[model samples]
Target: MPDFTTDHTEPAADRVERFQAAASTAFAPLLVRAHDGPPFHATIRAQATGGLLVSDIRTSPVTVNRPAGRISSSDNDVYKVALQLSGTMGVAQDGRREVMRPGDLAVYDTTRPYALEHFAAPDGEIRTVVIACPRHSFAAGPDALREVVATPVPATRGVTGLVAAFFTGLADELPNVDASGTHLADALVDLISLTFATPPRPDPSALTARMIAYCEANLSDPTLSPRTVARAHHISVRYAHRLFAETDRSLASWIRSRRLDRIRRDLENPLLAHRTVAAIAARWGLYDAPHVSRLFRATYGVSPTTYRRAHSGGF
Candidate 1:
């Protein structure tokens, strides 16, 4: 991969304009603005390694915005994973905000709206290594990725620290690895992905049981979902699904079955027979009438109304 470096002695304004264009060209559509005054300096040294676009940036104070108006399905799904090498950066997305210091890691989706501010230090410059990774190449699916966007993955220790160290080393090695850097790039991505994954547990069964218990307790909540369950259990959506793979049904189907079972129990209770099918369904968080009817018929070989009538002597 041939490296491209842009650092010219043009006027401060022209330098900003050219830097903004170059930054956008290097990544996706971005509005880059120089934050400090005249004679501002910046450089963007970019290289493509494996399937990743790595940009080593050193610039004066600047702010970058990814606007909603510029977002489209046709726009690339590559996410920007920034490793703060020097100074600080403020990141905002999905209504969450955080400031990243040196050795910190953060990711942002290109297809969504986000904001970034590269703040100047006492030395009057900030440096960052930004890697662009496509959605498919990433290990975490979209849901998991959304869980982490604009959220700082601190490089204080452990796997995150190791990942940050790799990026720091890659900055110097990137200029020389055009011929043999693909494997290294891939490993770095995998490690970073692992850093964002759920923390390890000694027993999958225990976690699964706890997650199931949470789902059962929250069945009356209309917003109950796999994602919500995962959040409640402090796990990943993918891991939550994996935990239920050996169960009687998939996680989603199991939730539906449990809700249907509760609805049936309620309908069979003679004291509760006055409640309508829709009302009973809603009581158990099965809110969509037509969809719930289809599920109920498919599961019990009868519609909710028929089942309720037969169970309660013609309700």
Candidate 2:
């Protein structure tokens, strides 16, 4: 598994330099901004797995200028899916103008010409989550998907929402992945395939539910957070909180419980005999051995080591 995370706050000039340096390597630049100043207060994370590239980006107010043409330098074909995480984004593609609000998703082909303008408040910024997949990898035909590309599609419901949620959840858990990273990556591909196979509809609640399930499946990740989950679903931190609240659990507590469950399972696995209790806990994002021991005792009424010793015989 390959993971990269960058958090930066620098002067406009330095920031632009960094942005250009980063973008030039991965994405082609027609017109790079932050020229006036770095208007984008941004957190950008990108993950590549099973031929899919997912990026979670939250930016301060800024304008990205792309003239009506594809970058002549890059020949790679990518289908870009952008979900508005906060505020609004105005996108113009093939002479059609679309306004994307929170919970809305839009797709654009890297082979075409389009312009995206991210709106910001006097003191606020715009946030978005973007997933880029090879055009050939999408389950639906390129033409079939193109009809919705660059147009505002609702993600608060239906298959699109489910897909958004899956991507977000996967992003959060990418860092803690171990030998099972390949399986997780394959699962993500399957989810994306499901998303493209479903008919479009409006069901934000349904999407949130699917997202919760995805999170549950990957609870061992220490990097999981409300922000990461929300970004996956193309929503806000507050909105992600609301979804969990509906389930009667805060995000943090839910993650903790998930880690505990994984530890419990590991304790019983005779094949994992060589791995220590602390190693298992750390694999699931529990860094402090003492803390894991304490939490295990509080929840399961026994220390992890004791639990492992008792359960190991069963396997």
> Each model's C-alpha lDDT?
0.81, 0.67
Candidate 2 C-alpha RMSD relative to the actual structure: 17.0
lDDT score for candidate 2 against the true structure: 0.67
What is the alpha-carbon lDDT for the whole of candidate 1? 0.81
lDDT (10s digit) by residue, model 2, range 1-315: 122223465566566556555543454454556423444455566666656666666565555655546466455577777778778988777655667888777777777777777776345756677766677766788777655555666677677778678756755765543433556556655655555443553376797777768788666677776656765654445556766787767977877888899889988999998988888888887889998899999999988888887889943
CA lDDT, candidate 2, residue 232: 62
**Clashing pairs in model 1?**
none
Q: Per-prediction TM-score, please?
A: 0.61, 0.53
| Model 1 C-alpha lDDT per residue in residues 1-315, reported as the tens digit of each score | 234344565667777787777787887777878775646677777778787887888888889999998777877679889999888999999876777888779888898899999887777669999888888888888887788787666687888889888877777776765734678778978987897764547599888888888989989999898867865664546667888998878898888899999998998988998778889899988889999899989999999888888988776
* All candidates: CA RMSD (Å): 12.6, 17.0
**Model 2 residue 206 lDDT score:** 92
Say which candidate scores most in lDDT: 1
